[model samples]
Target chain A: MMRIEDILMTLRMFQDENCDVRTVTLGINLMDCADSDLATTCRKLQEKIRRLAGDLVQEGTLVAEEYGIPIVNFRLAITPVAWWAADYGVDGLVRVARALDQVAQEVGVDFVGGFSARVEKGATRADNALIAAIPEALASTERVCGSVNVASTRAGINMDALLAVSRSILDLARRTADTDGFGCAKLVVFANMPDDNPFMAGAVHGGGEPECVINVGVSGPGVVKRAVERLRAGSPDLNLGDLAEEIKCTAYRVTRIGELIGTALAQRLRVPFGIVDLSLAPTPRIGDSVGEILQMMGIGRVGAAGSTAALALLTDAVKKGGAFASSSVGGLSGAFIPVSEDAVLAEAAARGDLPVDKLEAMTSICSVGLDMVCIPGDTSAETLAGVMADECAIGVMNHKTTACRLIPVPGKGPGERAVFGGLFGEAPVQPVRSGGEDFIRFGGRIPAPIHGLRN
Target chain B: MSDNSQDFIIAVMAKDRPGIIAAITQTVFELGGNVTELSQTVMGGYFTLILRATLPAERKESVIKQHLEEDWPDLALAACVRRYSPERLFEPELDTAAYFLTIQGEDRPGLIALITRYLAERQINIEDLYTRTEGDAITLILQIHPQNRQSAEHLRADLQNFGERQGIAIHLLHRDILRATSEVGAIRRMVRQGGCLS
Candidate 1:
């Protein structure tokens, strides 16, 4: 029999702290489904995805109930659509996206990702067409998500491609303006993107993966926050080192839960088990905020002086603990502070305590960059590209996976709230001191840094 | 670590004091035997121990009981001995997942009776249990095993009803998760090995 105290700790984690398996993404490679005809390609892609993912939701539900751990979302990722649809135009790609969305709904998955393009070097016809289709494809389908990778450590930042993507972000946000530009929330721009990230809107079954795989994302920001609070209460002389150890141990336990559920689901589905993305993806719920953990770690205000150091300590300790817990740890295994998704972070943004500059600084140490941050409606595409360029530079120079998911709520300005509702939450349109029109217009490529020539 | 054919199971109950184990082992040593396995518990100042021992030669149950009574004159003890058989093993846990059911409520008459009856109605077996009361705070920890998944599901619904009607705060969790958190090597058993308690 297990110790009763240990049993209660795990119980409290599940019961009050909202610890859960954030997502179980079923990645199905769709390279073989491609055909010369667009209709035939979409039909083949839908058939393959449906056949592979038909049991995904049902099996995931069964496993969750069996273990008493809630699996928040059952999602699907496929090979990047631009890889095989080189000749398909924007309309054809939109049709393909609708097919993916339909099959995802048929299988009862919450979202389908990889309506995406990779243009770290330059954009092909297919890549440009996919970017053009993203605004319509995402606005028409409720469950489809899109992503574009415009930078890498080795290939540097593709400024021209990012400019096109900046325009697409505006178009997508404008299409869903009534919902606080929610369509843009489902699209991400990444540098050094992971192939097996289970988190949307960046998940992709990129090259060099199996035919079918299962990657799990586990999150428990609330659990770690409660733990830190308990340690502070229990010790009069507790230091930052002690607090970090507490977070590490808590992360190890939660990551173990993720690996357990993911491996079992993969075995039942008879697919290869991929990796567990131990990113602390928080919800809009109060207690489940990464900002709460940072506050409990002694940062009085989220965007205050010590924000980046606190975030650096958090992400590094989490990676260390999760890496020890599971040998198959991959993807963006760091702490996430997505504004609006985390209640405290959103509140800080609304109060003007968390400015975009401070957020950008924090992202240099955290998981993703400028996540779920809403900007003014009239922010130009050039400025949007500028925002993405600065964030992508951090990623390329640091050799980390960084991304930006900026939502420009049409007709909303600074100090006005834009509500996306549900898990997307609501936040004020953070003011952007926009400039750089000339510099952004002169778009070419930012050459790779000297350190990037590791090969 | 010797497994002999002539194995006997013994039970001893006495007052809470030291030297109880030494006396029992001393008597068993006189019979030229080795103690194989044992479980011991103490409740309300009384101690109970059950052990299995292997002997080179088979001995009567009466002989061991009488020898312990005459050998330790100052200690009053009640003892029972019987032949040990592998086929007669009594496994309290069912062939399904084990769960931890925790209960916290006010101290009242018939509370244990009510809880045990609840478990009995659902056909759940308690593999281990302990209760503590300190300054009006009572904590009851129960390790229960249901016969199958359907009964486990029923127990969950019943548990919610019991908690609500009885004004209690209760939580139920799988035992494997506790092991996964506490034991470093146990997660492999739960994941790669399916459901084994290593």
Candidate 2:
């Protein structure tokens, strides 16, 4: 029998700390839904999605209630439209995006991803069309998300494709200027992207995945933050090693719940359970931010001297614990430091303590690169590509998945706020300096790094 | 070590003291018995123990009771012994079927009777229970098992309403969750078992 203290402590982690399965994303491969005619393709896509994911939300709710944990969102990741519906140009892709949005609403999902293009080495005709359609597709649809993979360790950075994608990203921001460039929040640019990520705006059913699967994303930044706070309150001499162990134990428990819920949900849906991603995805709520976890680690102000090391500790401990908790762990299983989504991180940016430069430095050590960052609208396309290029270089060299969701809030400058309501929260526009315009305009591939050819 | 062995149930209660369990087991050992399953607790000023032991088939339940009373007369604790059989099931499948029903509120009376009656009417069994009071606060924790496939949601809703009426907080959760968070091996064991039913 479990002790009464242990039972109440676990309940406290839920009722107080923001521990939840952030998303239970059902990945459905839509390669078979291809058709030459646009309407046929749209109908086939919608029908297939409805057939597979119609019961996802209801079953997810049942599982959440049974487990006594919050499964906050139900999302879908379909095979990239660029691969299947790419022969259809920008207009056709936008229409496909609309159909995806409608079906997402009908099936009661929060988001549907994989309106994406992968032009790592070079762009095919399909990749180009999807890249062109990204701005309008995201702007026109509510729940549809897009991602463009412009670099990889094996194939190096595709500068040409990245330049085109940056322009589209800028266009996307302008198209939703009414919401302070919110449309760009639904798109991501990645280098060496994971095929099985269950979070948006980068989630997709990659080519390597099964036909249909259930991937669960669990988050508990607040849980870890509280654990650290408890340790600090108990002993003043508590060392980093002790802190790491505390985080590892907390993360292990959270991952166990994620895997349990994932297994139960997969059984209920009758699909193979894909993986449990134990990333500490924070929300706008207080105590739920990875930034606050750093604060609990003795960093008084975020973006101070040791923020990167703190983040590295957090991200590594999370992965170590999650690895033992689930045998089928994949996706981006590290701490997310999204500025706008995390309240403390956003406030730090707003106060100029966490600058774009410090954020980029943290990107090298955190889960994903430069997530949910708002930049000045006057920042040039070349500068946008430059930022992507720098982050991609880090990922290519380190063999980690790095992505950027940089929204240039139109007509907003540094120290001004851009609000994207709900989970895509608000952040002050960060200043972007112009140092790499000449290099970005050169527009040629940076060949794969030497270590990338280890195999 | 002998094949011809019989199991005996032992119960003892006394004023709370140190070494109560050690003395009872010592008495059982001298009687040529081996302790198998035992539970002991000290609440308020009273100590209580219930144990099951195996002894040679020759030793009867009355003989074991007489030995315990004779050996530890000064202890002044009640002792009872009985022959054990496997004909009756005393507990539900505890490993999987256990849940915790917790009630917490200002100090009051009749909380257990009120909640237990509700559970009894629904055919749900309360296998074990514990209560603690500190100042004006009181807490009752009951380990319950629902034999049939009952909708936990409905039970929760009903409990919430009852809690509201009584000005207390009542909650129910699976025991596996507590075990999973507290024990490192619990989760891996669950994955190996596979196909977990709610």
Candidate 3:
């Protein structure tokens, strides 16, 4: 006869292993539904997303209950509609965006990523038109998220695309400044963008993926933190290698549960299951932070001397363990160091311990680049362009994916902080490097470098 | 960036010095080879250099390798040169998983031996490693690519028992590295469709 405490302990142990379903992303492939005719495309998109994702919220909740894990959010990733939306002009863009909003509301998904364009080397007529319409589309749509990939490792930096995106991101921020740069929040500019990332305003269905695939994102920052704490409790003799192994073991269990849940969800949804994205994606909550994990790693704080090595270890262990657990573990599967969403990181930024330069350094060893980074409202578009250029350069040169979603909060200057509540947490407005008059001025097209054509 | 191309991996090992890069670079330059990609790190008094140098159609790997050895013989060097076969570039079925497998214990002598033995049995490949001792504890972060079908849980379980016997705590996290995000895919598609995939 087991005591109630023992039962609770077992339950807690399981929860500690992989407690939460990080994300249940319903990928709605809209390519088939898209029409060259603006109104028809909008109508089909609206109808298709609403119908496909309509059961998302309820199904997600039920699945979480069944698995004894909490499903934190139900989201959607649609095909990038910018190319298709160009036919009807800005108004057509507006209509399609509004329709997406309705679909999101009806389906009860929190966010829908991939209202985007890819202009790394250059833009298409459709992509150009979509770029022009981004500000309006983002402003009007309540749930639609937009992303533009303007740089690659081999391609160097696409100055023409970066300059245009800089202005557009500024325009979006300015238009929606009152709403916590809400429009800006909807936009992300990326390098080496992934195709089946389940996280949004960055998620999109890659052409290589199945028609419909359920991708799972697993989150267990607190669990990993707890393991670190326990290891450090009675014994002080443990070294970094031992600590890293503990993290790897913890991540392995977490990833196993995620694979089980994702596979189950895909089976039930009748969709082909995609990879279980093992990204240590965080939220604003205190315990659920990648920074806290770094702190647990005895770095005192993130962005310190041992931060990169620690992250590299943590991230690599996560991949090894996750790869063994699931056959199709794809997407951004490393430990994500998103400063804004992780409370500890945000606090570090707020307190000035973690600077932009440090964050840039951290991204080299970790997955993703400067994400949800907040800059002063008065930050020059040129400086933002430079930041984008630097980050994209890392992506293109390294042959990895990196992105930036800079929110120059209007009237919010440096050292000021804003709390956007929920997942889009508060962030101290980091100051941009001054004096980009030269690089910004020399903004003619930076020709594609000779190395980008690796495929 | 033409499709009619080849890849060669040139690994340079030598004593830590400043001009080693310059000398190697000059050799590539004189040989009409372009240094396309390179990463170098100095550790424990040795400089390790890895480069993916692109050679024009006329110059082959043998010529490039010969130039380095014949010209810079005095620079105590061991070179491992291999041409990049086409298959290595795009084997989609290749396991793309990258993770940091960490092992910690009470500074036991056989901790690494035990962990690596298990990993070896499962055919897991370690990409990078950083290990050190803090007081009496030993920690290692092994960036690994586990073979297909072997679960991280199996390693975690094996390590757990190993740690118990060795009086240490072991942890594992699935660090999924190199898995392209959805955004990268969209960019590739959009670029291809836009006639910019090249």
Candidate 4:
């Protein structure tokens, strides 16, 4: 029997602190939906996604109600479409994107991922076609999300693919200039992307995954923050190591809740249960910012001198706790610092306390890199490519997952705000240093680092 | 005491002291009793215990009570003994799911009666409840098991309405969430057993 004190503590965490499962994504492999004809493939793809994911939202609601924990989003991730649409042209890929968007709406999923291609080593002709069509496909669709992997530890960095994606992101921003370049928010560029991540716009049903599986993403920055505050108040002489211990214990509890709910939902759906991503993903809601956790750790501001070290400690402690709580921990199981999505981070960005360089530096120790960051409109494609290259280098050298979801709000400059609303939140455009055109134009693969030759 | 071969259920109460358990169990052992199960707790300066044992079938309940009173007269021990039947050994399967409902408000008359009446009308069984009053504030923590699969949304709305009418705050949550957050070993056992039903 559990002690009454334990029960009351958990209740306080839920009622006062913001602790809840972030997302439950169903990854459905759609490689078999391919066909020689474009129309047949589109029809078959929609039918298959609708058939597989029809009950996903309803089932998620049932489980959330049963557990009394709010599941914020129900999403779907499919096998990379570029692989299936290899023979098809750019027009054919757009049609497929439209079909996916339609099916996502029909099934009531918030986002459909895997409109992507993996070109870390080299780009196939089909991958090139999909990259060409990204701007239009994203602007036309409401729920389809796209991601491209351009680097990895084994393959080094594909600078050509990186340059192309940078240009595509520019075009995407230009196309959605009305919504402050919101189209770019739906696309992510990655290095060593996880195939089973349940969060978007980067989640995908990798070729290695089963036909269908349920992956859960758990979040609770507020719970950690509260625990830290309580510890500080209770023991005025507590040190950083003691604070980290409290975070680890709190993360252990949060991850276990995710595992329990994910397993129960999977059992009910009769699909194999996949990983539980223990990332401390924050929402725009007040009191749920990962940056606030850094502040609580005594960093006065998020981008102060000791911010990176603080984030490293936090990320490592979270992983340690989550790894112990669940054997099936995978995906980006660390702290996420998406600027616009976290209220405190966004405020710091606006206040000039957190700059793009400091954020990039923090990425080396965190989960996702440069996530939900907004830059000035006139920032050139070369500069964008340079930013992506720098982030990807960290991932390759460290052999960890890193991604960029940069939005260049067209015609907007630094000190201006771009509001994307909802979970995408809003952010003030941060200034970027220029003069990287020559290096970005020198487009070729950055060969694998010395660490990549371990095998 | 009943026949030496019979099983007996016994309850013992006395002023809480370190040697109470030793003396009580010694008395039972001397009566040719084999202890099966035992539970003891100290509350408000008094120790209480319940135990099940098998003893000589010829031993009568009155004889065991008399022996406990005579042996622990200084401590003023009270004991109850009765024959145990097979039906007394049966325990119900814990198939029903559990939930935790907490209510907080200013202390008032009939608060517990009013809320319990609502649950009783809905066929929700209260497994355990604890209430505490500090100054003018009262907090009630209740563990419940619904007789059937009830829609949680409906229950929440009903509770919300009740809270509004009574001017109190109510929170209800599944017991598994609490267990997962508070007890790592319990969650491990639950996962290893392939379900959160327990």
Task: Output the worst ten-in-a-row residue range by lDDT, candidate 3 chain B.
Answer: B176-185
Residue-level lDDT of model 1, residues B1-198, one tens digit each, is 245448889999999799888899899889888898989989999999999988655578899989777788777878898887779333433336888888887877788788878887887888888887777667788998886667888887677788999988887777767777787874545666544211
- Tell me the spans in candidate 4 whose CA falls farther than 4 Å from its real position: B1-4, B85-95, B151-157, B185-198
lDDT of 2 by residue, A304-349 (tens): 9999999999999999999978787899999898899998999999
Clashes of each: 0, 0, 62, 16
Candidate 3 per-residue C-alpha lDDT over A1-455 given as tens digits, one digit per residue, 9 for 90 to 100: 11222222224434344457778887878888777676778778877776677776776665554334577778888778765555776667767777888788788888888778887777877777677778888887788888888876655567777888888888888888887676887888999888888887788875676666788888788778877888899579999888878777767766766665666566556676677787888888767788988898887967668887888888888888677656778888888777778899988888888888888877876778888888888777788899888888777777788888788888888788866778888888898787865786686556555676667
Docking class of 3: incorrect
Better of 2 and 4 by lDDT: 4
Highest TM-score against the true fold, candidate: 1
lDDT tens per residue, model 1, A239-353: 8899889999999999989988888788889898899989999899889999999999999888888889999999998998998898889989999888989889999998889
* CA shift of B116, model 4, Å: 3.8
Say which prediction, candidate 3 or candidate 4, comes out ahead on lDDT: 4
Better of 1 and 2 by lDDT: 1
Candidate 2 true-interface contact recovery: 0.40
Candidate 2, superposed: residue stretches over 4 Å from native: B1-7, B16-19, B26-34, B54-63, B85-96, B186-198
Better of 3 and 4 by DockQ: 4
Shift in Å, residue A369, candidate 2:
1.3
